[model samples]
Target chain A: MASAPAQADLRTRLQNFIPKLVLAPSVAVIFLFVYGFIIFTLYLSFTDSRILPSYNLVGFENYSKLFRLSHWTTSITNLAIFASLYIGISTLIGLALATFLDQKIRGEGLLRPIYLYPMALSFIVTGTAWKWLLDPGIGLEHTMHLWGWESFQFGWIKNSDYAIYTVVLAAVWQSSGFVMAMFLAGLRGIDNEILKAAQMDGASNFQMYRRIILPQLRPAFLSAFVILSHLAVKSYDLVIALTGGGPGRATELPATFMYSYTFTRNQMGIGASSAVIMLMTIAAIMVPYLYAELREKK
Target chain B: MTLIKQLKLSAAVLALTATTAAAADVEVLHWWTSGGEAAALNVLKGDLESQNIGWMDMPVAGGGGEAAMTVLRARVTSGNAPTAVQMLGFDIQDWAKEGALANLNDVASEGGWDAVVPAALQRFSKYEDQWVAAPVNVHSVNWVWANKKLFDDNNISVPTTWEEFEAAMQTLQDAGVTPIAQGGQPWQEATLFDSVVMATGGPEFYQKALIDLDPEALGSDTMKQAFDRLGVIRENVDDNFSGRDWNLATAMVINGEAGMQIMGDWAKGEFVAAGQVPDEDFLCFRFPGTQDQVMFNADQFAMFDQGGTVSEEQAALASAIMSPSFQAAFNVVKGSVPARTDVPDTDFDACGKKGMADLAQAAEADMLFGSLAQGHGAPASIKNAYYDVVTAFFNGSFDSETATEELVTAIEIAQ
Candidate 1:
């Protein structure tokens, strides 16, 4: 017991190693399942695969074919429109709700759950509910006609130019709630003394938000953008359930395109290439953001 | 050590799977989850259950069966393939090429399938001169189901030619009726487009462009003319004909809201479920100018290989699928003709009789080509390419000429 310093250092070393050992299993799983499949997908992209994976390598043949496809180009254009509107509008609505709820208002507890309810439902559920509600013959349009408003119509889901926006509508509706919850947490976490101090410094309510509160909520905004963008990139079930990428490929996303090509279209190579490209796009956005966050914590 | 490891793994697998992975449970993957379709499937399920074979239903519901196909791929790649998969057309052949399908040679030989099943179906049933799938029922997509009351009330005679069909559509349109109930789903649009192509240029053209992938035929004026006719048909559709299900379109025709629907024989199941009589409630005719041709798609169950130890239950299931009585019973409910040419039409209704007659005549006349929209005539890539071009054309994104150009380019690239 008295042989103290060396023995104590050994104990500390064992404590550090125990935590790493506990983390090892999960780190190994992530490396194999997530990154390993990614690498497999990259390998499959270079081959002449069809309904099944074939190892007959044709190099960049699949990538070139993917580029030449009008459908692929259409899907990319749709993603651009979808991702922007999805992120921008979700952030705005989320921030607004959070800020409103941040007010010292009555029944804030009841209002918060109602706002956060949509996030509990899966995108598939959201897509199906919205599809029925948006269909012209069945939903609002039919109801309007029944109510003697014969000219009223909301058939944007069936229109190619507008169908992508409908997807954005559903995506934003489902996700804005979660973003609001995050912003709300951030708003609550702000030091109350800062607001008091701002008021004492002659800052108006607007000025208080502009100077003190908004800046403090930067982390929430960053998290919201990152989460929503990742969701946007990998959106498949919603597109499948809502429109099946139809009305002439109007709302086709890269995820749907990849599945269709790989499984149904017998263009597995091109599908794999599209999947790889999607992974790269996500990594490009996420890698820097993740690194910065970790570095800041350090 | 390796031997011991292998033996241990085998023992664990045997222990775990001993209860349910018994030889008789035929795990059949299919996409028939609709009411009438499920009812028809029940007939098969009951038949198998009676034969002491268990039926494991793996229903992945999407009309196109793409979701089920994805599931099948993942299962097969992971070495957990089902006993059988409900596949059709080139899809079966595609799976067969990957060496996943079982050779149903014993069942085919015992059942005399080659003698009873139609040659057109046999083209898909076999790969490398060995039976890989058992043909179940034949579905023709060249039928036009008309609202009998509406047509009769308007004095619209049964149209058997393009001119008459146009006159009928125009008459219905002029009378404030939606002429044709068409869905804007890509496959539905492609279905309409395929019918137009066949109606305009006949089966030979369909075979060349869709089946053979002849670039000349794809880009030719015949293809262009087909697109032109498609444009004319597009005009007859209602304003809200986009993104609707095929059954809903059939419902429109059923309720007299729409004059006619161009769909496969399976649409008859919808009419039947609605309690409509064949010729009394709805009349059937070939898509105009396609009277000589029957655009066909057949559903078959391709059994998975058990590494040369094919089970008796699998063989029995294949034989049962091809049996004349089961075929007749299944097809009667399924709204398709039996794949076996020998199955009598006594149980069939008027529309069914007409389908059988047209199928017979088309078979004799050598005009019974498989359907492109139904994944029969070509692989999915080429089929989807055709769908893209045709749908874009139908949606007014492309004219006849540009549609032709794009169609050629797409098929060439896909092929």
Candidate 2:
């Protein structure tokens, strides 16, 4: 017993030390690159940095200037529309597909992959394919006309008024499948007894889902909302590939705005400010979720 | 043990050889990844190779040169700047201001770049009387490319003024051919506006408003007129022009699907690629009323400081870029006129020859202004601000008055 205690003390300390040692490099990397660059960007937002980073602090000038620009305003407005629609539509489509699959439908395996296949493709590919499909000239309209459908029209991609919705379309198409997978897992994890009891109580199918199934899938819905919302906010590639933030900056998200200002527009200070704002937005969504997630685990 | 020793010795030898070989090679960061562009870059690469200098090709493709600039900034900031970078417009100036670019005065003076290169290009090539970049080719942005067959079929002559241009577009529209083949991207919209501004208010107004970011000029009636003309042009563009690449618009003109395209001379590359002959299959004209002025964007190779030492490779690269032979060889393949005035237009097509002549005429008159859309007229911030306004007006997001006001405000805020 004396030997066992002595040996266990060294082994326990070694075990603890080894894991931290193994994790040290990645932790330091995350701290230095992710958090460090974030802090650096925060500092740069207050400065007069342009084209390149300069440390001549100008207080709230960049922030003030950023707010005054209509482009920034447009980007913010687009993000609001894109985020709301992308999250709402994707969650709905995902839940619907998951619910349909959960009914033990025929060819569920084939249909499931087909649904998830779009998610497998990168946003760049989805954006590009959808861009071609949505274009009125060489895309769907043209194809339909060639096939003798003279009155076919799907030119939302070209309409500034509706271009953000097209971005919403492409983003939702890509993310919905993944959302479906999440919901499907949640649906599978539901207790069969709960559903049987609902059936025994003579509840309608819709009522059963509404009363029992839907409430249990809160975690999945939360995850999907969080994931889809962040993806919507940080969307750059899809918009870039599909809209390039145009038909007159109609699809200009905050991410694209930050990139354009920082690298292309040479307004690093404003770009940094926009980036800090985006970080704060993500943090606003992420922090409470993380806190709740960890608190529940504890 | 002996085999290990032998292997270690060979490894040492390989390392020594690699460093020595790399010393003579110039690392070039560029976005010339397209087929024709890469071929044109090969001309310079071969020229550099002929001079016994190696080339480290760093091609970052996307956003025109936006992605390349991002990579360049990261490289420069990390203090591992490439030996040279293909840059455009005020980008060279921005880099030079940061003191990351090396002084190319010695090679420039040796190559007689000051006398041979146009002053408009030299404006970007030099910083504080020091040559920091070497211009490769001049890409003029004010040209209107039209399908000659469509023009002939519609019985329309090449328009020389804004009203006549409108009449021609109307004829094309009535004839059921798409009038203007225009991409709907901000830069493309801004490119059309570049010529429209030059056409509407002439070069001096463009100089005052765009380059100088002058509030009075931006807010003036002339600016509104420019927007009004742009609005008319916008009306004529096909409905599906949004998010279309410049080349696709060019193809619309080439295939006779669209009557005309108001685009840069670079669109000619698409025409050439599509096997359409200029002056026969298509006609390249100055955007109406911009015949006297040239809105240009030049591609230049900017050498980095590299710890304040101008290596032989950097100097050779600069000198090679300025040489008349390389300029001619590169531009002919790249579908642009040579940057050098002295380069003969014998090898150029009809449009290329006209571009060279127009460039010379405009340069002589001090009318060679940088294209605002392509980041030559102003710094990126101001140019982008201008783009926001121009694009907004074109897309019906703003009226002429609102666009003008927004233009002035945006430029001021960018400043």
Candidate 3:
């Protein structure tokens, strides 16, 4: 302190402020673009806006209409179907693959990249490829028929009753690899000494995995569930590119329903309301998980 | 030597004039991105360029103009609307009511659009007694394209009545032929249903049920009968019809994999692109029960009131769209009859000529109604509700009576 000059001390003060200075602009951007728009959408949802947003407030008239639409109900039902199957199946498959890969198999490095490659492609690409493969007229069913298996049928993408499952399929295919990578990292983190100890205790492979390693992947499971449920709720591109929410609104998700109402059908208020509902749904899933995680960390 | 010098001088003079052309640059927003549609649009673009007016193409394709309309709405909301936007039916009227559309009375009056354009089309072209849009072409949705060989092989006449159409469909089915090649999209099903509605009842019923939104007419036995026929028509389609694109369905008919497709005149554009001749390679007929009537929806360009350097370009574009030569050239390639009655049929092929004739007959009989699939018969909200119920019914969630009731209920809620 005695050796420092006054100008040098001022320079030190300025240097100390740089990190906050650098972070301020992004903070402002996120505030305005994300939270501000959310508030704006919330305001718009209560108004009698159409094609374009108008400021004439109508006090939940839009919400009443939204609930009355059968299509909106259909979208909700489809989301429930998609989210449960998508999350459950993806978790099971990802965990199984992770466990299989954890067995010290040969060519592990090669197989790891192969399993994770689908995660690198965008949901749009995944959707389109799956659509082509599932379309009965040009895809596997047609090829099978040409090869003298004329009775083979795998046209689930075209059936209204089963169309959402195709969306679930595409979504799981896109995300399961990512989930597997998460579980793999978790599995690698477990102490090798504990496995040897469990082996010394006469624990079989399945018993060790069931009693110890699987229980240790708790955090991974929670993270996977949180990420997957949010993705399932916010899924728009996969539905749009795959079946376009159709075969007659069969595969429509909340995101697609929101876009159609807002942009296509000229019901801005209804669209905004649906978007807010979706946001609330995601919040409902995320808030509790995040709270528990943060409390545990503390 | 003098003639050569004169030619060079004229070429230099032309260059000078081109460089001296006006500073008005027009940005056009549309969804016409398909190959044939792009080529057809080039006629208007070329006409503009020849006049030294520049065209800025802003095209967004998909969802049957829904995406383009979305872009336009966002632009208008942000106060940066384009000079012109391609719109259909009630959309033009909707924009005009918003006071965002430019008044085109000057160009329309000078071009004598009143006498040339039909009265029904003029209903959408004008708003509050002022011309707001220029009609490009009339697209009638009640068309059925069939493989000519299949009809001949089955020894079937082009069906004119619903009963005969059912009989022909049954014959084709018995012969192991797919009776209809339909895409499993809501709008396509709604398009087919619109034709069905007109067939089951007359044009008057169509107006009351669709245009006027009369509850009684919508819930009446006539509407239920239309739904019943739709149920049967659903059975005649191929199992793989779900989620198919309209063009692929058209391809099925062209390749003789399917017998017929009930689609719009745009399907002819596909056949033409495939090198199939109309009435020789394929039979283009009015869908059964829709004879002597035409369900018309016009594609029009609405000029937005950009209010600065863009207004001149907007007027220029409007006048050029209404010009007789452009109408003839554009409609010949667009697979629809010209909006202008004065454009001759000499250049149109067999399908186009038949379209023109039917359009004229429809105009005379007062049978032209806007297409629901093209955003005309109702606003987007109400029309989408109808689509929901109709498509759900077509896919077997509802019986005919229940579908009719649901349609009426949807109208009430949306209205």
Identify the candidate with maximal TM-score: 1
Model 3: colliding residue pairs: none
Compare candidates 1 and 3 on TM-score and give the better one.
1
Pairs that collide in candidate 1 are: none
Model 3 lDDT per residue over B139-207, tens place:
999999999999999999999999999999998998898988998888889999999998898888998
What's the lDDT for residue B183 in model 2?
82
lDDT of 1 by residue, A1-298 (tens): 6679889999999999999999999999999999998898999999998877889999998888889888888899999999999999999999999999988899999999998999999989999999998889788899999999999989888777788888999999999889999999999999999999889999999999898999999889889988899899989999987887867887899999998888778998999999999988888988998888768766
Global fold similarity of model 3 (TM-score): 0.92
Candidate with the larger DockQ of 2 and 3: 2
Error of 3 at A242 (Å): 1.3
lDDT of 2 by residue, A11-66 (tens): 99999999999999999999999999999999999999887789999999999998
Worst 10 residues of 2 chain B by lDDT: B61-70
lDDT of 2 by residue, B1-415 (tens): 9999999999999999977876989888998876667778899989988888888889997535777888888887787888889999789898888788888888877888888888778888899999998899999999999999988887899899888999999999999989999986778889888888888887788888888888999999999888888888888987777667687788888878899888888788778767778888999999989888888999888988977778888888888888888889889878888888999999889998999998899888888888888889788888788878888788778989899899989989999
In what order do the candidates fall by lDDT, top score first? 1, 3, 2
**Scored by CA lDDT, what does every candidate get?**
0.88, 0.87, 0.88
**What's the candidate order when arranged by decreasing TM-score?**
1, 3, 2
Candidate 1, residues B320-386, lDDT tens digits: the string is 8989999999988889998988888999998888888888887888888989999998888888898
Q: Which model is ahead, 2 or 3, in terms of lDDT? A: 3
